[model samples]
Target: MHAIIQSLCSLWQSSWQGMVMGELKYRKGSGGSGPYRVSASGRRIVRVSAVSPSGERMDLMLFPAAGFAVGGRKAEGGVYWHTFSADEVRQYSASVGDHNEIHQTESPIVSGFQIAEAMEGLEGKQDFRIRFHYPVRSGEAVSLRSEGKTVSGMTDVLCFVWEAL
Candidate 1:
């Protein structure tokens, strides 16, 4: 995921300077290690897609700078909360070789990958899509709630909305 982000940013003729992940769709079955094929389009909303050796696909939408809105509806009722500590965020960033400075600040924001990793029961799920609505700062608690096909992660404002595809 980090590699893909870097590649896309390079293709955009920019760095991670102002880039943000807007949405991600992953199809998990049949993928092997990639010598993947990737493509990108759009300006305001950069759309990127990757196809792996076995035809597995991942699509991503990105916003350069603050191209997308920041806040969203709060998660309500019967939700599970997870608080990612600064240390955990740092560790995950290091483990993933994503040394983005945003994740290194005193009050850092969790990376999108970390949020997705924290979600439970994703294993063996064939496909899923997640839209990032807001950033989850370090030490902030995120509420996770599942209803039918959707799963949401929220603080006071929604951070991400997820669905099984």
Candidate 2:
């Protein structure tokens, strides 16, 4: 799950920088001024630092081990459910320039950005982390419940500058 989340974070950062998965270059090392790097320091959590071409920095953390144990408790608000179709997947893929084979699944995988967007009242630049336990297939439904002010399974660290360029 750590490796999977790391790869997804790489893909997300690449899209945020307006670059395709093939266009973004990666350096293999920790604490560097490169595209992005992932590291774990004797902690159960993993961190990923990414920088765009314009010098905007984003720090992402993955708590693969902290599943329903961390923010798993129920909160106020209804469960937000969403479903994506194969055609919608294709359209989004073209828009984001990400055509990974996993998107072709019967219940195609949805982007984290899209999931965050589905949550109401999350406008403007905001930094956040999301963990997906299951794939929301093309025809299947995926739901997100809230935990107090923040959405469940999401941690609000800071405001993130999303570049659509």
Candidate 3:
């Protein structure tokens, strides 16, 4: 039964959850800014920091990332469009799958998908208004903060800025 059990474990691991996300990430925290207009049911909450914090201790707050207004406040030929989810946000070196690394998965670290890239100009048939100029990279995001604590309601978040590797 050893072989059977091993196979079962591997299968279970792959199918850990229906956590159907386009990618994965860990959220550290939002910039020291916020309360932007996100949507009719929520808020965007924005903050533009050139960089994040720095330290060796794991007990940090946010990641070393940056962000911009998801709306039209951007300058001509200096921005684009992008989108992300909460499951993608996470603490650094988090679990391989879903289940809440910060609160359930791993030993709670800070992280999230910050804006992977940003372009200057673009000309195409845009689909989403709230878009970025470039695509969100595997280890990139537009960082933000969670409300009321619990790392759940991490709204309109893009990336988490950590000190370093």
Candidate 4:
């Protein structure tokens, strides 16, 4: 029974990672022909067009999570890395009213607030959206990196998208 349980747990973990950290795809070009563009303020603008649409937009002014400096520059931009512990997850859950059991398990899923907190003051919250492709497990360090105008991590998984308002 012990062996069987261990095998099952291993299998589950493997499957979970596979699903969550799936292959990530991104564009490698610099420019595009769209109604929107990466603004000078690091935000994106989606102008109304004949075949396009418009809405409240905001930009993601990214910065290093560590607040470090490089080449005399105060780390203008870098990736955001964080590892949420069980206790931290619980505290965040309680504060945000997220009582899902999925967060209380051994893996201790992370909450959106946690990510937002990590990104606080770095992104324009007025017009932004966060997508959770997978719930980060406890002690699993995840890095949110800037990909052009979007922030992605974990197999290029899109963690947050910013637009202009």
TM-score leader: 1
lDDT of each: 0.70, 0.39, 0.23, 0.40
Candidate 4 Cα errors over 4 Å, as ranges: 1-80, 155-165
Per-residue lDDT of 17-127 in model 2, one digit per residue for the tens?
Answer: 321111111222223344433433323343445554334344444343223223333333444445667778756655554445555455555544444444313423334
TM values, all candidates: 0.77, 0.45, 0.17, 0.44
Segments in model 1 whose C-alpha atoms lie over 4 Å from true places: 1-14, 31-34, 41-43, 67-69, 120-124
lDDT of 1 by residue, 1-165 (tens): 444434433444345445677888877646466576778887777788866666666687767646465456665664657888999888877776555677777887787767655552553445778899888889887877778988778888888888888
User: Can you give the lDDT of residue 14 in candidate 1?
Assistant: 45
Which number leads on lDDT? 1
* Model 4: lDDT to the true structure: 0.40
Candidate 3 accuracy as lDDT: 0.23
Query: Cα deviation in Å at residue 153, candidate 2?
Result: 7.1
| Candidate 2 lDDT trough over 10 residues, lowest sum | 19-28
What's the distance in Å from true for residue 117, model 3?
Answer: 9.2
Task: Look at candidate 4 and tell me the lDDT of residue 1.
Answer: 16
Q: Write the per-residue lDDT of candidate 3 for residues 1-165, one digit (tens) a residue.
A: 112112212222222222111222222333444232111111122221211232101111121122332332222221223333334344211232224233233222222222211111221211111223222333223333223321111123432221111
* Per-residue lDDT of candidate 4, residues 1-165 (tens digit): 112112222222211222221111112223335453322221121111111113223212222212221122112243557667998887765655444455566677565445644554465433344444444567865665576566653423333332222
- Using lDDT as the measure, name the better of candidate 3 and candidate 4: 4
Clash total of candidate 3: 46
